[model samples]
Target: MTGLLPDNDLLVQFSQLFQQRTSLSNMQAHWQQYHWKETIKLGFSNHKHEDWKYTSLDRLLQYRFNYAQKLKISKQQCDCLALPLDSHRLVFLNGRFIASLSDNIYESYQVSSLVEQKNIPVAVHAEVFLHLTESLAQESLLIRLAAGKKSNKPLYLLHISSGQTDNQNKNIINSSYYRHHLLIEENAKIQVIEHFVSLNNQSHFTCARLTISLGDNAQLTHYKLAFENQHSYHFSHNDLILGNHAYAHSDSFLLGANLTRHHTSAQLNGKGSYISINSLLLPFREEICDSRTYLEHNKGHCHSQQLHKTIVYNNGKAVFDGILKVAPHAVRTDGKITNNNLLLSKQAEVNTKPRLEIYTDDVKCSHGATVGYIDIEQVSYLRSRGISKTKAKQMIIFAFAAELTESLKNKIIHQQVVTRITKRLKRIDI
Candidate 1:
């Protein structure tokens, strides 16, 4: 109540509630203490801060939301949120893991529920809201892959949020605050796909954080898919750390939520490590979405690349901020960052910035951003090819996104992403 978002009485109240619940939650004692202190120190985000200037969480503070203590739904409802058949899956409802609805694996991997464990791994966190998320989450999802092995099948995680299913808790609005931790041993390779969805039209808020650690010579592929309802709010953060010779690739598709914000931070901790961050953000109607990323070259021979593309239609808005930093000792580093935007309506708006901070003169870094309308010549060419004007425009926009999608290594997931994106484009009337 004494910090940034104190002006909103609802958020202030929720902060107090979360503070009081920390003692009752199952999180480890040491982490609880750390989170409590941090939450008290870093209260809420405001529009005045440069990092939060383009987005506002003030209006969302107008509504009150509660934590999910008990579930009141059937198995069939949970099944609606799973992935394709026979896939390794984990499901969470309102931030609590559901084992019965999950697939018990027999692979050379380990899956442990943090709520039932005694120790939690170190997290990759940089923002203030992260403290609040840790203070409220009852338990986290922990996944570990064995060393020197390649996963035969990709893993899927489904997070379902339905506001207050039981009538007895009708006055308590439902919200989820969860964290996920992933660890890959040396010479291991894994792929993870995460889906966030809302089961009902009720207004809910989902705040989550993920931390990934890759050992030497490890590789990881991560995909984030957001398809929440317009009545819901979504906030997420992913922190990745790679060791020597490790590789990481992250893909994000932001297509829903009334108000959404995503933060991705990757740290190249050892020499010869690399990472690539790619995202496609499409917002229609009155939705507002923000994507922020930071890549740190901590050691020599490290590389980072970012490609962020967004399409804003109707009165919707999008924001992108990308930063690349090279340490003094991180010589021979290579980095490139670019942000491209397509605006369909005069009412649509975008704010994009690509920043580079280098402490070493032996690094190569470049950054740029572009915002433009659909190319008329390209549209004309498509139209001449027997395509309608609207269809041609849609095709151009889709092609822009395909640059990122076509690079996906998983053929099934690539097709699914394309299909879902096409459906959303059609709903916007091309």
Candidate 2:
């Protein structure tokens, strides 16, 4: 692929595959075709791109991945990967919804297939990956919560990537695309968790997008958990729109994938809207994780807070880019962003950039970043207390992650996250 230009081979392969999928209606096909052209025009981001400078796509683009025509996964396999919590579950294998593996829809909320819906929303951003998913996704889900309603349990969206092997018994890279939309009306409240996992150790690629809208006085708690195999590549985009007095809290855990990129954008369009985003990224053994967030305060009295932490080990790398913008009329806005990184290995690296652009007065905004290693004094103290050096370092690392994982209100989810963190830390040599 040329610099900043679309990969012609990949685009041609995608076009051929898109043409073979007969699920889309005539109108839907036409709609998707328009996006396909836009995707080509926009092309993929290169290392020169400011937003992608710290994360390189060269390794991801080198492979030619095929779409999985069929997927085989058992209920037992899915159950093994599911969180131990009471939730309304929807399962997808290779981007296709698996009704047999999903829970029945309850009366408290409305759920429908995107292909069956007459009105399809436009893409929130014009990026290549976002548009590519919009153009090629064969299946999607739309969920709506009515006014004055509240969900008794969280909604769980599970995605599994299962790639096939060639005749030589060698694994062939596979690709999957999926889109989801959620709407919460006035006075509504709900929690959602989007979880991604791999059914096998084969290399694969997954692209997903979720769009959410919150009406006046609505509340939403969102979580994204990625646990794909270490050989996989993953990308996700989230768009959120908030009305007056709306509130949203988002937490993300990046624990897998050889190369992973997550981007989130929130528009505070109504007065008194509030949003908080917290993320914990653990990249070890040559893994790379990139995270970006954009918050726009369009109305007065809007508030936003972001905290991102990364633990890098064994030549792993992490990136964090955050931007907070306050419009001219957005008075009394409050925004804060902070990123902290802990490197356990001399070869490990982190790049963090936090920015604020405020056009109005009476707004309080701040941005900062810190990159450091384990405190030698603390480690010495623990060693003097008869603690092993490795155990002391592990304790400090766990404490750094616990500061954010402890914020999870659900006991089951919190414990599960902690368990994963512990498991990963055990693999560290330190």
TM-score of candidate 1 on Cα atoms, chains taken together: 0.92
For model 1, residues 104-159, the per-residue Cα lDDT tens digits are 87376698765533434455546766776776777776788889989887878888
RMSD of 2: 2.0
lDDT (Cα atoms) of all candidates against the true structure: 0.81, 0.85
lDDT of 2 by residue, 1-430 (tens): 2457354456665677677654557776776787788877866767777776878877865666677766767899889988866899989899888889899875577888765445444444446777788777887778899999999999999898875556354435788987898988999999999999888888889999898999999999999998888888998888888999999999999888999998888899899999998899999988999988888899999889999999999889999988899999999999999999999989999999999988999989999999999999999999999999999998899888877998899887788788888888887798
Pairs of colliding residues, candidate 2: none
Which candidate leads the pack in lDDT?
2
Cα distance off (Å), candidate 2, residue 268: 0.6
**lDDT score for candidate 2 against the true structure:** 0.85
At residue 336, what lDDT does model 1 achieve? 99
Candidate 1, poorest ten consecutive residues by summed lDDT:
116-125
The candidate maximizing TM-score is 2
